[model samples]
Target: MSDDPTGPPVSERTALRADCASCFGLCCVALTLTASADFAINKDAGTPCPNLAEDFRCGIHTRLRREGFSGCTVYDCFGAGQKVSQETYAGQDWRTSPDIARQMFRVFPVMRQLHELLWYLTEALTLPAAVSLHAELRASLDATERLTRLPAEDLAELDVSEHRDRVAALLLRAGELERAGVARRGKRSRRGADLIGARLTGADLRGAELRGAYLIAADLRGADLRRAELIGADFRDADLSDADLTGALFLTQAQLNAAKGNAATKLPDSLTRPSHWSADRLPTA
Candidate 1:
């Protein structure tokens, strides 16, 4: 983490960590679910998940995956749940005041999006190669943070796309500078490439730029992705069981959560191993 007083932009250590204790099961109530393989049953929006407890805990928390609530395991509000419950709603849960339920559900997602931007902005500021753009990044971060604290009505009407576009442009420049600073020139850039299920085991991809690549279910076991620019790569179901991603750039927890990985997968320091990856499913030494 960058040791920034406002907290590391992307590290969900405390500020952005999911403080479930302070939340009122917003994820369960606000998010609609379909009876896909990931979920056991279809659920409507604004209705609480059947497994939710009165105290806002998942009744089947320990057995969520086996119990057909696998989708819940990968969801991360990035502390937006707690922020809405504690900060925005001021400790008033939707259950106690049913009238505010609709507004609270609407505000939760907006806060989550704003928090996602904060993560990206924070990461950009830490890149030394992007120093020239630091002033603008900081300003954007400050402005974005201010927006997260707005009233629910204003948040609902927020132009998130505009803010996202602004942040994305700044990040693109930052990525370019970082890539240029690297000693190895002419690195591979498979940006927006469709490499679905391609057998790329043990491929040498150091300093690769794979921004927005479609890598779904690709067999990338033991591939080296150190310092790779994965800005918007689709890693869902990607076989990264033994991949080296220690210095991978622009990778987020939400992205990792969606992907398939095991214990041997080397990840960035700021992120943690997903709970869904069991020891039996990991790559053998």
Candidate 2:
């Protein structure tokens, strides 16, 4: 799995999904969390979380949301965790190599961003509406994949924000082309709208541009979100139990993680339902 141009195939693209079993608990270790509405305690970067197990698994994985670490449920390393643990580090454990702990921690966040670009590029290529841009998309995808395979020294020096900016531009163009119905959102664009705790159940948000919108705790049960551009929208604690999100573009796992959803919710093929979320769980009235 060293530098390969072809990258992971479409089927294997899903395999790029985070395999926490093969990971070194990077999210729980490399990342930090302070006592806030999200985490219950303060954790400095590079320190292993108290809930981290000997096998690199979260000891309280299932109880994370209940234990006041609801933020943990929203974080996704986008398969970077496994790639770093198994490929980049070549099976070395931090316990044995305390010297490389800093490098490993730094590389994890960088790799996660790179992997997220891979996810977007992979998804962009899947959209048939952007058929004309496929060649350019493929080129960017291959280049991003190659970057992810770079050595730790190179990765630490990478201009991750620059790469993300370039990739974001491309994804934006693709989203525009795919969602020809973009004009349907409304005359008043809700871009970055602050609708926290608003009563929006069953609202017609089709094709709405809600990028960076703060939707924390918004009650959106059964909302029609078809063709909506949900890039960077916060769904934290918002009720999405019966929402239809088919064709919603640019939404991330992190955003979805912050939301509450159930079996009736419709999501894109690229995402899987949070394990902590269940069908029988009723929305708070």
Candidate 3:
């Protein structure tokens, strides 16, 4: 995960998959929806989408983009969607067993978070600049992988968010260690920014304000985002492949997501893709 949000081609980096067939449409059934550009109608957690076929496939999947459902296009499964459908419940249909359905719904979100962490950890391991943090990254990767393999019942019972927060602390430390000598001196304010690792990949940003920012390892694959405000910043190892940006606002995407934001999440151009886990409603940046 480079500092540039839009550093490399998404194809070059490992993209998580959505194995829907293996997961019995758990994501569709477990998650709720509100009417917006992404979904045609509103839905609750347990009910299946009207377009869901009996075979467990989306009826309008092929036409989602044209049928006013582009939101579905950006969604990623991080493998949890399929894992729960097949491995966790052993291909058990949530529709057939109300209890299992409830459990599956409960665990889907948790697993999604776990998968997101896995994505970041794996990406971190690929960075040469982060060589000093390799040992820490590997440890975090192992821990995150173990969490991914937890049994349904245990996963349902575990405090996955707390665990994610704990792991995130280590990752943040790694970033600090990697950029130790590069720290800027000054105070800035970047409240509620939505960076999510924008593909700055090599832009020139000197002395910007980035408080409560959302910069999740955006392709910054190697841009310079230094000497910025960075109060509650977020930076989840964006791409930063080889850009040049210096002295930007905020710090990381994780910091931004954990902080408060209104309808003003200033995002990087490259990370315009909507989150699959997020509802169609825009974030109150």
Q: If scored against the real structure, what TM-score would every candidate get?
A: 0.90, 0.90, 0.62
Write the residue-wise lDDT of candidate 3 on 4-90 in tens digits: 432431222233456676778776777887888657789998788788888888888778867876556655566778767777787
TM-score of 1: 0.90
CA RMSD, predictions in order? 3.1, 3.5, 9.7
Alpha-carbon runs more than 4 Å astray in model 3: 1-15, 96-98, 176-191, 194-285
Name the lDDT value of residue 216 in candidate 2.
Answer: 91
Which prediction has more favorable TM-score, 2 or 3?
2
lDDT (Cα atoms) of all candidates against the true structure: 0.82, 0.82, 0.58
lDDT score, candidate 2: 0.82
Alpha carbon deviation, residue 186, candidate 3 (Å): 11
Tens digits of per-residue lDDT for model 2, 165-255: 9888898888777777455635356878999998899888887778778899999888988878788788888988888888788777777
TM-score of 2: 0.90
